[model samples]
Target chain A: MTAESERRTEIMDAVERLLARGGVNAVTMRAVAAEADVSLRLVQYYGSTKDQLLGATLDRLADKSVERWQARTRRQRECASPRDIVESFFDEALPTDRESRGFHRVGVSLEGLAITDPDVAGRAYQKHLKELADHLTGLLQSDDRSAPAARLLAWEVMGLAHGLGTLLMTGQLSEPEARTLITNYLERLGPQLCL
Target chain B: MTAESERRTEIMDAVERLLARGGVNAVTMRAVAAEADVSLRLVQYYGSTKDQLLGATLDRLADKSVERWQARTRRQRECASPRDIVESFFDEALPTDRESRGFHRVGVSLEGLAITDPDVAGRAYQKHLKELADHLTGLLQSDDRSAPAARLLAWEVMGLAHGLGTLLMTGQLSEPEARTLITNYLERLGPQLCL
Candidate 1:
């Protein structure tokens, strides 16, 4: 990577760390500089404002999340069923590990920001949702030709996964309980998937 | 209301307003005092600290949310079915209007805080989830005779509603689309609700 690009990644990484640790309120230009071990001027050089920095970071995070899911799907056997795809999504989306937990925190933070700040973070959030929805919809469509509402199903799966992730992260639902819930849901959805 | 209790409610209303307008970060003791039109000393006299104030406000919000759902259920015809209960939940949970939108924002902010500050906000968030889950589960159990997994189903409904709310609030899904998605979900879930 070029030196400039490397510095940019370093700064973005710092922003992610701050967001994970303290939500959106914790992220600032000075905090990014301190976290990245660079000067505030250097941080500003990369992103002119906090909103710009956050927007760029959210864009990068969104892309990385989609890429991660794609990689997971690729690792699975070819022609994975809708159930398998959804199970894999839950397995990845749930914050069972520290890394996944941090990612979930960042996601919740972005979600909160998307509601309040519709310009930068909101747009980034919408793009993230659209990309994930499209990817999941395409996978489901390929797996089941007879299912006419694959797109809606994809959105349902995405919504459920995101909500369950929050419940898991917040200690509302245990991991085993969440898994069982998904299993039961899939069992009920089995016939629909086939149709 | 008594003078003391009325004062407490006033302070909390100010907190909720601030939370709705700008999220958790917008809330502080000084800001709360300013919003409440009270002395800063009075604010501290009531809660002692920011965490205390936030915790109390969350507890009140949780209670109010549960109460709101109860009132809705009571207003419905006697013996509302599982589908009816779930539909009512979505109707109330979605941030379609200004008041509901503000409430949703406060919810997201609390959710974000529950991740970072588990002691104060996290406990409150869990209580909120538990109360809602219990309420919904009980309603489903009363409505259905043979459904054994009512609790899990309640969580599923809550999760989906929440995730869908975020999607709607973020403009990823239109109101009509969300309604149709729920309708599709209910149709698929109809057999299970009966069984």
Candidate 2:
């Protein structure tokens, strides 16, 4: 990678770390500079402002999350069915592990920010959801007789996964209970999967 | 209402306003006092701390939200099927109107807080979810042949409502789009509704 791009990634990583530890409130230009071990001027040179920095970070996180899912699918070797894609989506989305838990925290923080500060975080969040929806819908549509409502199904699945992730994170639903809930959901959704 | 209870409601209302406007970070004891037109000492007399104030506010909001749904169902004056209950839930839960939109904002703020400060907001959020799930589950059970997984279904509906509410608020999904998504969802969930 170019030296400039490397520095950018370093700065973004610092932003993510701060965001994961605290919510959106913790991420300021100065704090990110301190976290990244760079000067505030260097951080400013990259982002110009805190919102820009956050927006770029969220955009990068969005792509990385989608790539993570795709990489997993590739490693599995077989052509994954719609059910497999969704099952794996839940498995990946749930905050059962530390990394995913941190990711979910960032997501919730972004979600709240998107509401309160709808210009920067809002656009980034919309892009994130759109990318996920497009990717998932494309996968579901690959089936010859895919449901015409593939996009809606994608949104529904994404919505459920997000909500369930919060429930799991907040201790409202245990890991086992979450598993059963998804199993039951997939069972009911069996017919629509058209597999 | 007694003077004390009325004063307490006033203080909590101030907290909610601050939360709705600026999120959890924006809510502090001093800010609540200023917003409520009361003294800081009076706010302290009511809450003792910011977390306590936020927690009490969340608890009251949770009850009021559940009550809003019950009142709506009662006004309809008919036995609501599982599908109907779920349908009305989406109708009410979606932040299409200003009042509901503000409610959704406060909810998202509390959600972010629950993750960052679990001891206070987390307990309140869990209670909110538990109360909603229990109420919805009981209503579904009244159907006499409710699915064995009524509680699971309740959580699923709540989760979907929340996730979709975010989507709607974020401008990702239009109101009509949300309606259609829920319609498709309820249609697929038809057999299981067992009504």
Assess every candidate by TM-score: 0.93, 0.91
**Can you list the residue pairs that collide in candidate 1?**
none
> Which candidate has the highest DockQ of all?
1
Task: Please give me the total number of clashing residue pairs in predicted model 1.
Answer: 0
Which lDDT value does model 1 have at A164?
A: 91
- Interface alpha-carbon RMSD, every candidate: 1.0, 1.1
Residues B32-100 of candidate 1: C-alpha lDDT, one tens digit per residue:
999999999999999998878988998988788777877888888586767778888989888888878
DockQ per candidate, 2 decimals: 0.78, 0.71
| Chain B TM-score (each prediction, in order) | 0.94, 0.92
Report per-prediction Cα RMSD to one decimal: 2.3, 2.5
- lDDT comparing candidate 2 with the true structure: 0.85
Model 2 CAPRI quality: medium
Candidate 1 per-residue lDDT over residues A1-195, each given as its tens digit: 999999999999999999888878799899999999999999999999988998899899888878887898888858677778888887878888887888889889888888886668767878889998888888788544534477888889989999998888888788999989999889878877764
